[model samples]
Target: MLTILVTGATGNVGQEVIRLLLNQNCQVRAAVRNPDTATEILSVHPTAGFSDHSIDRVPFNFTNPATFATAFQGVDKLFLVRPPNLANVRKQIAPALEAAKRAGVKQVVFLSILGADRNPILPHSKIESYINRLGIPATFLRASFFMQNLNTTHKEEIKTRGELVLPAGHGRTSFIDVRDIAAVAVRTLMEDGHSHKAYTLTGGEALTYYEVADIFTAVLGKPIHYTNLSVWNFIKQMRDRGLPMDFITVMVGIYTTARLGLASHVTPDVEQLLARPPLTVRQYVEDYRQFWL
Candidate 1:
């Protein structure tokens, strides 16, 4: 049986990846910051039909190189994800990759951002370039804005306040689903034909802020509005909301660059990999309706 190490195993994509691999009866080592939180986290996923499989919730901290010594032992594959703190990536991912390579891990599937090559100063790009240099079997899965992102803070705010605010002027996004991202990652890690492959994972269709608002209205059965503010205005709004300056800068850069025709490109890669159609926005809205209210 192939053993896989899953970094960030409790996050959105990581959680989905873990569930899928477990369904396939793969030996999974969940590298978490805390083992005690693992059971509670899986319980919340509500994997009603999922069969129990072997899961080792090991304490692994990316910034701590010593933790990787034990975490990478006997691992064949890794689902690599940089934590939410963009600033700490160098202190984390750089060392983890080295440990995986040293452990003789066969394959590595990385979750990176779209257009990572364009902005060298961007943390996502920096990580992408770093991973690209490693002389190992690597797959970089570059993804655009996720619809699931909205399903979090964006959805709550919209449901509570009836407003969608952002600095994406006239920029449209074909937001990929986290489920699709997970599918690509799992397929890359477990199957053949994906080594050294770079994929731009995207949504089935591109939709602007106005179009997204229409979809929201149809699903929630309530009026919703999309406001496209200037980049400066968006930055100001986020700052006022108490977001960190570094993250706000990154978000604004992504938003403005996206407006210039970066993430608007649609790709059929998800369908190609999954052997079926990717989920549509309306379907996502319907499936997650309970959260919208």
Candidate 2:
């Protein structure tokens, strides 16, 4: 059986990837910072048909090079996820890819953001260049903005005030679901014909914040308003909520990308990969309605 190493196994997309891979006939090694707490971290995900013992937990950290070799050992393919905080690709991610190369990892499927290739300063683009430099056979899954951001980043605001607050003025985002991204990752990792290619993953349709608010209202059976704040006010709001400057800056950058209309491009890659249309915004809102209430 082929063995695969999954980085960021505790995250939303990682957990979904592992869950789907567990249903297949492959060996999965979850590379985590703390192997001891892997179970606790993964318990939040829905585990319908698999047990925790099925996944081998190995210690891995981007900042620490010592854990890289051990985690990459005997792995045929690797799913790489750059941690949100680690923007310095040279210092943090290079060592791990080097270790994976040294360990003879055959394939790599990296989770990257949309437009990473054009944006030179983005860490994902740098990492992509590094992988090519190292001569590793790889695939890049450049996914659009995740729909789950509503449930996670803006959930508090929606739940408490029934408002979607952001600086994305009149911008429509092709918001894809994390589950669809995971499915594509699994395909690239486990299947053939996907090497050395970059796929821009997006939902079936693009929706503006106003349309998103309408969907939320229809699903949750309550009026949800989209509070479009100015860029400066958005920063102030994040600061008032005691968020870190780095995180606030990242959020601002993402919203600015949307405001510029760069994030509105729809793609056919998701349907092409999954053999079906990607999940719609209304579907996501309906499935995750309890979170807003």
Candidate 3:
């Protein structure tokens, strides 16, 4: 069995990727930060029908370099997720890449943002380029904005205020499902012909926030609205809400990028690779009903 280590295994994408890998009866490892996440995964793993796989649940913190070796031990494949914390996040990625290289891991799938490999304005794009130039065999899944983000965090605002507000004006984004992203990641980790390739995965439609709101209202049978605030106003709102400067900066940059139409367009890869059509916004709204409840 191929030994695979899934870092950030407790995350939205990580959990799904780990589940998909385990379903194949592969030797699966979950690298989590706490025993609670491990315990939760263990309880659900068998019920999810993955108890037969080699379940190596290990603790690995991005800030702690000493634990890297132990988690990398006997590992042949890797699925890397960026830690949620932005402080020293870049500093941590290179070392982890080095450790993966040292461990002789065959292929690494990075959950990178769309346009990260090409957008010169965003720092993540530079990091993605640097990783591409490295000696190791790596694949960057430059995924679009996850639809799940809106479900959890943005949904609160939408439900309370009846509006979806952002800085992008008349610009569209190919908001994708994290579930689809996980499926692609698992396929890349398990299959061949994916190395040296950067896949730009997206939902089937490119939609502006207004159009997105309309879609939600149509699907969910409720009134939803879109407020296109100026970038400064958006920053002020976030800052007034006590968001960190780093987060505010990145979010402003993302909106700026979107205003320039960076995130627009649909890709055929999702349907081609998965042998199914990517979920529609209607489906996303249905999924959000569960999230809201």
Pairs that collide in candidate 1 are none
TM, every model: 0.93, 0.97, 0.89
Better of 1 and 3 by lDDT: 1
Q: Which should have the higher TM-score, number 1 or number 2? A: 2
Name the lDDT value of residue 288 in candidate 2: 81
Q: Which residue segments of model 2 deviate by more than 4 Å? A: 46-50
Worst 10 residues of 3 by lDDT: 45-54
The C-alpha stretches of model 3 lying farther than 4 A from their native spots are 41-55, 87-90, 120-123
Over 1-293, each residue of candidate 2 has an lDDT whose tens digit, in order, gives 99999999998789989999998889999999998788777766743434868999999999999888789889999999998888888998898899999999999999999999999888889999999999999999999999988998999999999999999999889999998999999998888999999999999888889999999988898999999999999999999999888888888988888888989999999999899999999988888887889
Report the lDDT tens digits of candidate 1 across residue range 102-127. 88998888888887767677676777
Q: Residue 86 lDDT in model 2?
A: 88
List ranges where model 1 is wrong by over 4 Å.
46-53, 88-90
RMSD list, candidates in order: 2.0, 1.2, 2.8
What order do you get sorting by TM-score, best first? 2, 1, 3
Ranking by lDDT: 2, 1, 3
What is the C-alpha local distance difference test score of candidate 1?
A: 0.81
- In terms of lDDT, the poorest run of 10 residues in model 2 is 43-52
